[model samples]
Every structure is written in structure tokens, then in C-alpha cells.
Target chain A: MSELVDCRGLSCPEPVMLARQALQETGNGTVQVVVSNAVALDNVTRAANQMGWQVSVEEEGEEFKLSIKK
Target chain B: MRDRLSIIFAGAVVGLLAVILVLQGNPANMGFCVACFIRDIAGGLGLHRAGVVQFLRPEIIGLVLGAFVTALYVREFKSTGGSSPLMRFLLGMLMMTGALIFLGCPLRMILRLAGGDWNALVALPGYVLGVWFGTLFLKKGFTLGRSQVQTAVNGYAGPFIAAVLLILLVTAPAFIFFSEEGPGSMAAPLFLTLGAGLLVGILAQRTRLCTMGAIRDLILFKDYHLFLGFAAIFVVALVGNLFTGQFIPGFEDQPVAHVSSLWNFLGMTVVGFAAVLAGGCPMRQLILTGEGQSDALLTVFGMGTGAAFMHNFGLAGSPAGVSPAGQWIAIISLALLFIIGISNVNLHRKAKTKDYSKAS
Candidate 1:
């Protein structure tokens, strides 16, 4: 299984940074980012898209899991 | 990138407006200060009895309206809130306490420095230090949590208030106070001030210009993108000051300024620290409010109330310097900021989650 990026409880740009790093490191396949808030979800989704990745989102409880792929 | 550089141009325009407003009749070195204007607005609304600084500033009204219009036009307006609203309100008050202690917001701080006010120099490091401290909290995973999307009416409230205030100013309602002396008595033409504010609001919203963000970005990522905007404001305003003969670099005899070094430093330190937790500066708060964020609206209310509280309790500083009470307020603000910053962070999450940065 691919490693998950747990960006939960992190502030604004931190979650975005971690998500971007995961995307860059994986270089292919899929990466999922779990964020505790919508702001982080938006930021990470935007960052991933900017890097030319496609993202699908799933809301689980109070957190969101963003699945990103090339 | 060309897009990032646009903020610099926007900052330059704002700087030019500051000088022009002064030439047109704003207080010396007081072009567009959010904290001062909000305080004056509070006094105008009779929230406080500060007679010398009482007027419904049209520039403030224009800022909200302009950003609201621009946000709507760009389809960027989204109504959202419910992330620690009460806490944000108090943090807003904390931010205002700092600004009042220093007699200016971050925007006004840059303008003060541009006007060759030596006092701003001392506040600069303090402000930087505050942002730095905020970065530490960020490193430890501090967050105010997520905000949920709200209905359209929620987003319209802030702009609606601004429009109402504009009408009140034009009609000269009896309920609102207008100052006969001191800074409140000084003002540019209503249309002119409002026009400048509108222009700034539109530009700022488009460029995402923020004083706190400028410092935060530099420290967090070593990215100087936002710093360009900060430098542009200072450079443009400084040159304008020189040509207009407003540049007088000294600690003494500066208009509406204090010579106290320790208070000035501590005051900005409070401002910077609280701003990070709150997610924006005073001007940014206004823009966010215009963009339909209820949390930002609460912060705005906090600032207005804080302004009233400062005057009512005799805690705001003047040219003479901060009172013992105001100094204590400053100290309390820092302590409160520390509590707020530390309490919100869930560092235990860090232990459960693996950092993605090591993936490389």
C-alpha cells in the first residue's frame, strides 16, 4: 500500500507542503492526504493540481482524504 | 513570476495613495491606518467617548465595498465560518491592542517607516520577532481548524454594513459623532478618500498583499515573493515623502508619534504574534470580511470593540507614550497569545502521523 500523508492538525501552508512533497516523492501511482479541515483540503488540492495531478476527495468523519494521481 | 511581481506594483500604488491622501488633507504620516480609522469609527458610533478622534471614515467604507464588488466579479466570493469564531474575535482584540499601543496597523507601520519615522525602526524588529514566534507554532502544527461553507447571506453581511456606513456618512446622521479637533477633525474629501480606498481594496484582493504574510512567507519558506510587496510600499512611500518634504527622520517632533522604544517594540510584537494566529493583518481582515468570511467579520467586530475598550479604559497610546495600564495590557496580550498558540496545536498528531517531507 502507498504511504498516506497525514496533514491532520497542521495549519494553512504546512498541509499543502506535505501533500506536495508526497506527490513529488511518489512520482507516480497514487497518494492520499488526510486533512482535518476544508482549508487544508483546498490548499492541498490546489497545490496538487498546480503540479499537474488529478485529485478526488472523500470526506470521512471530520477529516477529508484527498486522493491524488498523475 | 510576473504574477507575484504584481503585488509589488500594487504596493507601490498604495504607497503613492498614502502620500497623496496626506497632501489632500489626511493627518501627517496617516494615509491609511486600519486601527486608527476603526477606532475613529467606534468613536463615531458612540462606542467610545473619544471626542478628539471621532468620524465615520469613508476610506474604510470604500475598502469593504470595493473588495466585495471585486470578489463577486471574480466569482471568488465564498461564505464560510464556524472555525473558532469567539476565539478569533478575542484574537482580533489582541491584534488591535498591539496596533493601538503602537498607534498604527502593519500597513500604517510601513507608511510610518516610509515617512522617515525612526520609531517604526524599533517596531520593525519586534514585528519580525513576533512573526518568527508564530512560525514556531506553525512548525508544531498549530491551526484554528477548518471552516465550513455558509449561505450567501453570510458573505453579504460585511459589505452590507459598509454600504450602510457610507450612507450614514453622506447623510451626516445626528447619531454619529464628528470630531471638531485633533486627528478626527482632519480628513480628505469624502469622494477622494473613498476612491483611494476602493482602488486599494480591489488591488489588494487581486494581489493578496498582506504585511504579515510578507514576513511569514520569508521566514517559513525563504520565499521572498510577498516581501517584494512590502519593500515596494516602503520604497515608493519613502521617495514620495522626500519629494513632498514629509521626510523628517528623527525620534522627536514627529506627528502623532511617540519616542518610547520599549513600548513600541513590545506593541508590534503583540501585533505580529496575534496576526499569525488570526491568519491575516488588520487590512487583510477587512478584505476577508468583504469576501464573505463570517470569522473575519467577527474579527472586525473585535477590532472595533477593542478600539472602544482602549479609549474607554485609557489604554491606547499617544505621542506621550503608553500608560502604565496600556503597558500591562501589552504584556497580558503576549501571554494570551502564547496560551492561544500553544493550546490550539495538536502535537500528539505529529507522533501518530509520519511526515511526508522525508519521502524524498
Candidate 2:
């Protein structure tokens, strides 16, 4: 099962940090990170990419959901 | 959709945060200002003998420390330096000089506007114009070169220094100065301020929220992503101020502000230009320094020194108006920034032409 990390109301580094944590703890599975801002979206994407994860993004209303898969 | 929501959310959160700080007694309409707080910090360190503005701000220290901790935990801490450190320092100093003349940085400018200070309305356009002008040079291929990766110790230095400063603030040593009165003497509770700083630092580092970058990107790339976030701050803050009975709109007699419209505009113009040249706003520079960018650390120090110079030499304006010396400094700084922009652009162009000639 994919793990979920919701960082919608949080700002930059928090979302990025949460996303990183989700990725790290989940090890090899899929991790879904939800964020609300462009900065968070961009940073989370960059962090996921750096860890060699394939990422897919979805727009949910005003929030973003990033699915990172190993 | 998500990007838009995130920007707005970030903006609203910051706005609300600023209002809360103000309500909690962090100076009227002067909540969460990086430049002003840094200036106060400079005074605290006895970098300047300015009695009225001396205080070790926990927010500044917390910002650096917060960013440092987050960067380390995420393994994004890469110590780097040697990217025109002196130039960055000069740009930072110039940036601070401009901000002090205007009595606030870009963040405070927006906060002031949110709190219904019309003077900020004037300064805003000047800031935008300055950033637009800087973008012209950027399009012409102006660059600050690249930074090389350094050792871990180098990366840790900024955060280490910040940590030490936090200790000094806590210890209240006799040598370190503290404001007995004035804006320097005013602040929210220490723990609250530190927490606010850490929270802002983390969020800013993650999202790369920068007021100057918001303007630069909007002008250059027609990108509204970052702009939307900052705009949200204004909107949210305005609403919060209205609700809290803090909204007072007019041109004159605003708290901690002057009615000198021309200087306010020109002063921020200098800031806008220097921030662009330095590749980030003051807040962004602090975040970068925390993330182990040595060049940015130098810029932060330059800002501190610039603040000291402003107060010590009476180049900083008050609610009364800009001093004659401050006016002269603003004019000179503007000229210096333009020179730096033009020369950098021309030098790059010349280098490109030389390379082409060699190829031919």
C-alpha cells in the first residue's frame, strides 16, 4: 500500500521534509504527498527526483498530490 | 490548481502569522521583517552604537538555525562558496542601505501595505520597476558565476554562528547590547518569536518564498506562481488587520513609517536592483545561508554591517523623513547598482564576442 503524507496547510520546508520522510520510511513502495503551494510542489518534486523516484502529479482543487514510486 | 492553492495558502498563513505577532506585541505593523530584525541584531552585537535599535532578535537566529536543521535532516546541506562572495557582500550591504532608507524590506513593505500604509503603495511600484530593470540585465546574460562545493565545516558555519548568537541572546551577557527603548526594545515573547522564525525558515527554505523573486519571475517569465503566494499574504493580512481593528489607511502618521514618498520609492529601487543582482531577496539569502551557501552568509553579514552603518552614520530615515546623508547614499547606491548591472552585462557580451572571433 502507498503511504500518504499530507502537508497542505504547511509551508515550504515542512512539506519538503514530510515528503522526504515519507519517501525514506516507505523504502521501496509508492508514497503520496499532498501539498498546497507551488514552492512545496516544486521542492517535493525535486526531493523525490533526487532520490531516484518516478513521480506523478495530480491537481486536486487547489492542492497537489504527488505520487512517488520507486 | 494545487500550485495556486498552495501559493494562496502560504500567503494567508504568513499574513495571519504577521498579524498574530503584531497582536502579541511585536511592534505595530512591524511583524516578521527580516531586514529590520537583522538591523536590530546588528545593533545588539555592538556592530553599531545605535542605542535605540539594539536588540538580539531571536527570530533572525531561529531562522538560520531552523533552515540549518531542516537542510541537515533532509540531507540537502551542501557547503558551497566562491561565487563572487565580495560582490554578494556588496550587494547585500547596498540592499540593506536601501531597505533602511525605506524603513523596511520587501516583506515589511507588503506587510505595511496590508496594514493600510499607503506609503508602501508608492514603494511597491518602485520595487517592481527596479526588479523589472534588473530583469533587463538578466536577459542580457548577466551572471554571478557558480559556487563550488566545500567541506562540511564550511556548510555548518552559518548555522553554527546563528546558534552561538542564540546563546548570547539567551545569556544576556553584559557585553552584548539590548535596546532599552524604541522599536529595538519592542518584541513578542522570546520563545514565540523563535518558534515563528523557525517555522518561517522551514517553510521559506522548502518553498523558496521570496518577495523579490516573485516580482522578478512575474516580469521575466510571466510566472504568477510565486507572486500568487505573496499576494495571498497581503490579502490575508489585510483581512486579519481589518478584523483585529488594526487597519488604518492613509498617507501620513502611520506607525514606524514616513511620508517621504520619493525616498521610499528610490530607496526600494536600490533594494530591488541589488536583490536581483545578488540573485535573491534578503529573506532568501538568509535561507540560502542556512542551507550552507557561504556566499549568502557573506551577504547576510554585509546586510548586518550595512544596518550598522545606516544607524551609526544616521543614513536611516525615521517617521520624520530621510536624512540628507541618507538621500545622498541612496542616490550613490542607485548609481553603483546600475554600473554593476551595465558592466556585468557588457563584460559577458564582450567575452561571447571574443569566443566567436576565436572560433572564426
Candidate 3:
């Protein structure tokens, strides 16, 4: 199972950094990040991609779940 | 489509308001300038003795009240703060200094651009560079730390003060100053200004409209969400200016603006850097204050204090251009921002991050 990083209600840059931290901890495994808003989702996706991860976002109600895998 | 339309609507309304306010008696192409308006409020309260820019702008009061009402209606108002309040306050002061030197905030920058002030173009690159610097800090884990839920009273302070200011504005008390002439004396009808403020405040709070965030998000996330709002304001304002015969292209003799290229660039650069560090633009800070964020409130307080300090000390810029002291303050603001940014960067990468949702 992949690690789940809950970033609900967090703003931009913070969510991006959290996703980066989770990715580093996994180190080539899968990581899932959940954010509350569109801005955070876009930011997290870009950050994960910059770190060489494949990202796919699933809308979960008002929150967005980002699945990032290396 | 709905979301985009809402943002566009918000921006277009703001653009239209600026034009209307200008035509109604506000300064030319300066229907809304948060930094300058806050400075005027400072003067109104006798915080400074600037003769030409003192009136407790009704629009300012209306914005805070409107945001206050909207946040409560939407069930989004919460009292939260305590993440480096003092640092945020200082950043707010520096942010004001930068904006005052530029003679406007980011919102005004967009308005000026729409009015065809090319000097804002020079400031644009500087603002972007400053935001890029801020993004570098974020990449290195720069955060002011998480805030905690504070008492409800803390949340009410901003709006409470705003309401009180509204009273003072209406009463026209003896202690308050009103400019006999100059930009301060120039204002749209009081009720009309207040109504526009309320409407824009609600829309801005609803859409999370922020000019500083527009540039920052573009650089950090390649996200055009906020930039769409930014573009809408520019486009709408340009059209309005053209229709109103207010679009005076070129850098010279712009209304309430000067032609110092270097200071214009650096002033906005300082504003952008400090705003990123403070977590929002000047207008965003006010909106957050209404939503009950004490950290943002302190920043707002700092901005007012900075305005007073700038005017009293003659550190503020005027149409004569930035004084030597104003130039020095802008440069020193950059140094201070660099120090604040570097020192706050957490070098240690926590394997498990702390709660950042509580972050501003």
C-alpha cells in the first residue's frame, strides 16, 4: 500500500512541499496526496512531476486525491 | 466554465468599479489603491500629517465589513493565528514601503497597466523576479510555522476596527483629518464608494482574488487560475479606460504616478518579495483580516504604521518621484527580505511533516 499524505485545507506551496517530502520518504514508491482546492492540486501535481513522478488526480468530493508514482 | 466565469465576473466588476470611482471624483486611474488608501486612513487618524492624502476612505471600511459579512454567511470565518505574528507584521510594513514607493499596490499596478501606464511594465518584471526568489525559498522549505486556533475575539478585531472606522468616517469627527486639497481630498461619493467596496470585498473573498498570488502561482505551479482573474481585471479596465477617455499611453505625466524607472522596478520588487513572505498581497491581507486571521490583522496594522512612518519621515514617494530616503528604504527592504527568507528556511527535511494545513 502507498503512503497517504493528507493535505486537506492546506494552501499552495505548503501542499507542494508536503508532496515532495512524502515522495522523498518513499524514494521510488507510490505516494498519495490529498488537497482541498484546485490551486493546491495543480501545485502538487507540478511539484511531483518536477521530482520525476507520474501524477494522476482523482476528484474525491470537495478534495482532490493525487496519486504520484515513480 | 462557471468557476472561470465567476472569477472573470469578480475581476470585471472590480475593473468597472475603478472606472466608476475615478469618474465619480477619485484620482485619475486610481479608483482603488490599497496602499495609498491605507496611508490616507493613517493620515485621517492623525498617524501622520500628510496634508494632501487624509480621508478615512469609506471603501476601506466597506471592504472589511463586506468580507466580514461574507465569511460569516459562508461559514468560513474562523479565528486563527500565531504563526510568527511579529515577523508577519514587519513584512507588512516593508510591503507597504515598497507599494508606497511604487505609488500603488499590485491591484493598482494592474489598474495602471490597464490605464496604459508603461512604468508598471518595468515594475512587472521586478515583481516577477521577487516572486521567483520567494518560490526558491518555498522549495527549500520556508514556512513561518503553523498557526493555532485563537479566541473568537481575535477574529473579530479586524472587522470591529473597520466598523469603528466606518462610524468615524460618517461622523467626521474633529480629531480626524480631511485633506483640503490633493489626492486625499479626491474621492467618489461616500456611499457609492462604500457600496463598491462591499461588493468587491464579497466577490474577492468569494473568488479568492489576489494579484500577488497571480504571478506567484504562475511561476510556482504554472497555474493560471489566479492569473485568469488578473487578466480579466486588466482587460476589463483597459476597455473601461478606453471608453472613458482615460487610457493615456506612455510613462510620462501619468496621473498620481511618477517616472522614475529604477525606483518603479525596485519598489514593486520589494512589494512582491515582502508580500510573498507575508503570505498575500495588501488587499488579500485585508480580506484575510476580515475572515478572522490575527496574523493578517497584525500585518494590516503594520501596514498602517508603516504608512504613518513613511509619510512622517518623508520616506514616501510622490509625483516628484522617489526621494533619496525612499530609494534607500526600498533597497534596505530587499536586504531585510533576504535575511528573513534565508533564516526561516528549515534545512532539515522532516520525514513526517508537521500539520501545515493550520498554516496561513
Candidate 4:
């Protein structure tokens, strides 16, 4: 099962940080990180990629849900 | 896609909030200003001895606390420091000095323009030029170096200090300064200001909304992602100002604003250059400090102390016009920033070339 990290209404490094934590907890599995802003979306995506995770992003209303798999 | 929409939404929300705060009795065309608020806070702490500009602004306190709480809740709090702390401190001081000379920061520069203050038109281009100048150094590999992770307590200091300030604000201690009747004396209700600050803090934290970064990114990487957010704020605020009847075209007799276009341009140029060198705007520094970046905390402290010095030494501009001292300081700051930028870039390049030759 994929773990979810919701970072709605949060800012910048927070979303990236949360996504990182979720990825660590899930190890090699998939982790879904949801963020509300473009900056956070970009940051989280970059962080996930840096950690050697495959990243795919989906738009959900005014928020982004990124699915990362190691 | 979703992220872009969110930036727009955040911009609209912030625009609306700024208008609401102005209508609710904050300073005209002054709803959310980091540098001005920090100056006021310095006065409140008796750092500057400025009688009229003294006030313990709750919004600033709430901003730090809000970011701190959110960072803690999300488990993203990391205490770190040791990345050119002294340089960061000096940059912060220079940044604040320039901001005071212009009577606003980057955010207020935009807000001033949205409210029809034509003075900002001059400052805006100067700001871009300054950022562009800084980007030249950035391309040359100018860096403050990497930060080292430290104990959690290091991250909590800014928040703890903010909490204490909130308490002081609430208690109204006799020693703590409060404005008698000036820009500082005029404020919205405490709860409303705090709410606005908290909201902005949360949104800014989420969106990484930085005016300097917006310009820097656009210049360096041709990225408009963050720039869109600022554009949204300008458009939305323009509409809001129109509705609030705050749109007074032309620059004459603008509240708390002067008419010297040359100084306006130079002042913000100082701000833009220093802010770019420091890696963020004043608001961004405050947010980072809340998130446990000790370097940012020092920067904020530097800003506060610089504000005090600006006021005490008559280096800050006034409604009449830019002070003589302020004008001199702006020139000196630009020259100093240029020296810092050039020297740092050369040192880094030499170091890199040395390492490359050794490896070969």
C-alpha cells in the first residue's frame, strides 16, 4: 500500500520535507505526496528525484498529488 | 498545473487580505510589510529609540509562530547554521537599511505600485537591475557555503523569542515601547492583524512566495513559476485597491511616501542586490528563521539592529524626502555588495580551479 503525505496549505520546504519523511517510512514502496503550491510541488518533485524515486504528478483541483516510487 | 493554480489562488487570497486589512484600519497601502514591521518591532524593543515608530506588532510575531507551528506539525523542522553567518548578517543589515531608505521592502514595493504609487514604478526597474547584477555573481559561482545540521534547540530559538514577544505584546510591559502617533500608532485590531499574519505566514510558507526569488528565477533560469504568483498578487491587488477606493494615480502626497524618484530607484536597488545575495527577501528570511535556520535568525537580528541604527543615525528616509545619510548609505551599500560579490566569486573560482588541477 502507498503512504500518503498531505501538505496542503503548507509552504516550501515543508512539503519537500514531508514527502521525504513519507518516502523514508515507505522505503522502496510508493509514496503519494500532495502539495498545494507550485513551489512546493517543484521542490517535492526535485527532492523525490534526488532520493532516486520515480516521480509522476497528477493535478487535483488546485493541489498536486505526486506519486513517487523507488 | 495544480501547483500553478494554487499560486494564483494564494495570490488572490493575499491580495484580498491586504485590502481587507487596509480597509479595517491598517496604514494606507500598507497591509503586509516585513521590513517596516521589523523596524516597528525594533522600536518597540527600544533598540532605536524612535518615539513615533515604536510598536510591538503582533503580525510579525504571529508570522514566525505560524511558520514554526506548521513546520513542527509537518515534522520538517531542522536546526542548522554555520553558512557564512557574519556575511548573512551584514547582508541583512544592508538590505534593511536600503529598505528603510525607500520606506518599504520588495513586497511593499509591489503593493505600493498596485495602489497607484507611481514612485514604485521607478523602484521596480531598479530592483530588477539590482537582481540582474547579483545574478551575474551567482553565475560566477558565488555561494555562502552549505549549512551544517545542528541540534533541534537551534531551530527553536527564533520561535521561542517570538513567543516571548507575543507575551510582551499581550502584557504591555511598561518598558516596551509603543508608538505615540505615527505610522506605528496606526494599526488594525490585534486579532485581525495576527490572523492576517498567520494566514500569510502559512501561505507564504507553502508557496515559497518570494519577490526576490521570483525575479531571480526569471532572470537566471527563465523560470516564471514563482513570478506568476507575484503577478497574481499585483493584478488582484489592483482590483482590490480599485474597489476600496485606495487607487490614487500619480505620486504626489502619497501617504508615508516621498516623491524623489531617483532615491526610490537607488534605495530598492540596494534592497534587491542584498536580498539576492542573501538568498531571499526579508519575509523569506523571517519564514526561514521560524523553520530553524540559525543563519536566518541572525539575518533577522541584523535587520532589527540595522533598523535601529538607521533611525538613530538619521539614515532612514522620511515623508519629506530621502535623508542625506540615507543617500550616502545606499551608495556605500551598493559598492560594498559589489565588492563582496566580486571577491567571493573570484575566490570560489580559484578554489574550484585548484581542485580540478589537483585531480588532473
lDDT of 2: 0.82
Clashing pairs in 4: A10-B206, A11-B205, A11-B206
Taking all chains together, each candidate's TM-score versus the true structure is 0.88, 0.82, 0.89, 0.83
What is the lDDT for B10 in model 1?
89
Model 4 root mean square deviation, Cα atoms:
8.2
Which regions in candidate 3 have their CA more than 4 angstroms from the true location? Answer: A1-11, A20-70, B350-360
lDDT of 1 by residue, B1-360 (tens): 565578889899889999999989999889999889998999999999989899998888888888889988986677878889988999899999999999899889999999989999999999999998888997787878767778888889999999999888989989999999999999999888999989999988787788998899788766666688889989999999999999989888788889889989999999999998898899988988888888989999999999999999999999999999999999999999999999998675432244353343
Q: Report the C-alpha displacement of residue B331, candidate 4, in angstroms.
A: 0.1
Q: What does candidate 1 score on TM? A: 0.88
| Interface C-alpha root-mean-square deviation of candidate 2 | 18.7
The candidate maximizing DockQ is 3
lDDT of 4 by residue, B1-360 (tens): 776787777777777877888888778878878899999999999998878889888878877888878777765566878878898899999999889988999988888899999998989998998898888887675767656667888889999999899899999999999998988898999899999888877777777778898898788656677788889888888999998799898889887789888889998999999988887889889888877888889999989988999999998988899877788999998999998887666332321011121122
Candidate 2 on B11-114: residue-level lDDT in tens?
67778888988998788888878899999999998999878888888888878888888877876666777877788899999999999999999999999999
Model 1 misses residue B85 by how many Å?
Answer: 0.2
Candidate 3 C-alpha lDDT tens digits along A1-70: 2347776654556776677778887899777787765556766776777678999888755567778899
lDDT (tens digit, per residue) of candidate 3 on B136-242: 89778788876666899999999999999988998998999999999999999988899999998899888878888888878876777778888988999999999
TM-score of 4: 0.83
Q: Ranking by lDDT, best first?
A: 1, 3, 2, 4
TM-score of chain A of 1: 0.94
Q: Model 1 chain B, poorest ten-residue lDDT window?
A: B349-358
Model 3: chain A TM-score against the true structure: 0.91
Model 4 residue B21 CA deviation in Å: 1.1
